[model samples]
Target: KEFLQWYIKEQGEEEENSEANVKNIKEAGDDLSAVDEKMGTRGG
Candidate 1:
């Protein structure tokens, strides 16, 4: 019973971490695209 509870807790933490990582990656991609647009404007 104790082992099962610990395992469930660890899995929940891991799932949360994975979700945060995905969100961070998406935000970074958005930032990069914005920077690219800014650079393009400067060139023009």
Candidate 2:
């Protein structure tokens, strides 16, 4: 039971970290898109 609880906690943390990374990636992509739009390129 103790191991299972620890495993569950670890899994939850991994999921949270994954979500944060994805959000950061999305923000970076948006920044790149904005730059492209400003440059009047295909990203517009």
Model 1, 1-44: lDDT tens per residue?
Answer: 99967766776689987677668779999999999999999998
Q: In lDDT terms, how accurate is model 1?
A: 0.83
Q: Which stretches of candidate 1 lie over 4 Å from their true place?
A: 1-13
* Lowest lDDT block of 10, candidate 1: 4-13
Best by TM-score: 1
Q: What is the TM-score of each candidate against the true structure?
A: 0.63, 0.57
lDDT of 2 by residue, 1-44 (tens): 99967766776689987677668779999999898788887545
Global lDDT of model 2: 0.79
Compared with the true structure, all predictions reach lDDT values of 0.83, 0.79
Clashing residue pairs in candidate 1 are: none
Candidate 2's error at 34, in angstroms? 0.2
